[model samples]
Target chain A: MKLLRNLVLAAVAVGGISAAYAAGAASFPHNLVSGIDAAGWDLSVRKADYDDDEHEGYRRFGGGHERHHEDDDDDQGRNYGQNGPGPAGSTTPPDNGLILKGTAPKVQVN
Target chain B: MKSFLAVLAVTTALSAVTPAIAGEVTLTTNLRNYGGPGAYLAYYVTDASGKYLGSLWMSGGKARYYEHLTGWYRATGGNLGEIAGITGASVGSGRTLEVTLDLADALFDAGYELHIDAAVEDYRDSPNEIVVPLTSDGSGQPVQGSRYIADFTYTR
Candidate 1:
């Protein structure tokens, strides 16, 4: 048992030294050359989230990659005021100091 | 049957004479960064005795998502008319949603409660995410939500 313990200790020591030798392995994700911002906050994403499950929304052959022609459906979620009980305007949202994230469209009363 | 008819007549007469006094009620919700699609929220009110009153607002245009908000869907049977005009879009992750409406004055300090049931696509359904008393002292005070909503507040 003592010999096995000694062997484990020696292996750990060797591993630590090899780890030190492999210093500065060139930061991957942190460096800009790796790729775009994975967070995707600033990405010019489509306004309307489509059901692209079947990949049936294929565009025409010419200039297909452009995002502008993807969907003409405006963010209908913004039109909450025009429908029901007059316009319920927005007040100043509080400064909660948390990072802002996702937003969902309102439930349509009609 | 005679007592019921008399009560109905009296109630109708009183309601016609005295319109319900209402004031502007604002509901503010702050969502956490759960890293998912926008959350579907259903906001409703209950009487002081915890009886369901009526729906106030719903955030999410699609009806299919309503069922995920199990509590509200059950209470309202996923009725679209219950939230008409009182609906708004969903709130994204780590964002805030502010909703203002003319609410009955009786709701405040009158043993009423405000409830919010929420659901997120591919995430857990949060029934009764927030249950706050409608007392005047409760206004402007923030309450933490169970799942998607981090904090919620109401103001006059």
Candidate 2:
């Protein structure tokens, strides 16, 4: 029957163009983290309200928000490594190298 | 036999380091709204036979909502390089996320276990929710979180 109605109209036009390209790549909206990161008490409040390459601060401070840091490196927050940490699993070495057992997390929440 | 191969390479480098003592480990979470979207959450660590040991934290950083964090993407199958640099963000809905990390004292009283898997977007993915049990008399007590996690705690 017309090749199953042209394969159901090409699977509904490829699922409506992949849901409109995932809603145009998260066009940004619907975010509502709420006052003081939902009141647990600011653990640097998304690094003082977003930076380090936003897009939700590159998934909570892995890096990228056009690199600018330094109010003594956001007062030694975000990348918390005392002096450029991150080197061992959890995304090792430079940005996104999340440094775990090596330590870093003086207090971070968002 | 060369002194039993140099005492089996110094007992395999002292049984791969387990002298431990470290400290600090706060971790606190609270979320509930079940509205939809923004929730990832991972936090893993297991032993007493549960196995899968690794990943400390990883609050949603996208990556397509990590398959609704289904038991930490089936215990790290969704790798993302084991949550690079630890990760953060995405914890809204009645919120609360304390975090503190450093942890070690042999992951507390030994027989470790600390989990949390959550996931939301279209809702319903909850995974392990929260397991807790790194007892030294349960560290600093506080627990409860089965669906959208209303509360959970751990301390030292």
Candidate 3:
């Protein structure tokens, strides 16, 4: 009986370890997305102009990518105006800051 | 028991190396001397079936001009988050905008594609300015753009 108990405990341990490994493996993409988010990138689901009926998945934009419209005067106080530090119409030269680009590589199981 | 050990070893090795496989990819877009003000450029990706994946970068900083990035603005509802850390200055005519970041290893040879959309303040909005496959072979290849972009290239 003691031998059988030891075997059962060993099996449980192995199972637990395997489950943890699988969980981590499955979370690779999520981790990638989180990394992107932590870097201050924005991800959203929007439509495609070419295919009006189709919806596109997550797209990452920069932190200062906000746009202020002519109708958004009320929100202008909170949001950046048309000519602020990172305004839409500023004639300032493009800053040479390092901008992260590209999406997480799509993973597939064959 | 041996098979299980081998599996564990392989998994451990893969986990350790997978993230490192993500190398930095830089995209340089040089706009033509279109005689316009700074151009609003939207850089994004798509899947094998041409489905919009996500945005990589946006050149212009403003939200209103984002609509000029028609395809991207439509797909993202003009969401600012898409280009959060990746936003930078707009490219002036004859100037270049460069974007660099770590790109995952899995996107290559999987029929994924990178696309750029461009618009000038008074000029017409140019969607799908440039489209290139994300592949190991295609890396470092420079492609010409349709309207605003004079050339585009990606490198490791």
The fraction of correct interface contacts reproduced by each prediction comes to 0.04, 0.17, 0.02
Cα lDDT, all candidates: 0.65, 0.64, 0.66
CAPRI verdict on model 1?
Answer: incorrect
User: Taking the tens digit of each residue's C-alpha lDDT, what string does model 2 give over A12-50?
Assistant: 999987887798954333344355466666645253554
Per-residue lDDT of candidate 1, residues A14-106 (tens digit)? 988777658854344455533466544464566886776454544211112212233222223333433322122242111111101122213
Q: Which has the greatest TM-score?
A: 3
Per-model chain B TM-scores are 0.84, 0.32, 0.86
Candidate 2 lDDT, B1-156, residue by residue in tens: 999999999999987885645667788887877665456678888787887777777775555446557677777777666666666656667667887867667677778788888765435666787888787788677888977889888877
| CAPRI tier for the interface of model 2 | incorrect
The number of the candidate with the highest DockQ is 2
The lowest-lDDT stretch of 10 consecutive residues in candidate 2 chain B is: B60-69
Off by over 4 Å in 2: A1-90, A93-110, B9-33, B40-56, B62-83, B88-103, B106-135, B139-142, B145-148, B153-156
Candidate 2 local Cα displacement, residue B24, angstroms: 15
lDDT digits (tens) for residues A68-107 of candidate 3: 3454322212234443223322222132222222232221
TM-score of each: 0.54, 0.27, 0.55
- Please compute DockQ, using alpha carbons, for every candidate against the native two-chain complex: 0.03, 0.07, 0.02
lDDT of 3 by residue, B37-116 (tens): 67777888888777777776667666666776888878888866555545555667887666666666666788888888
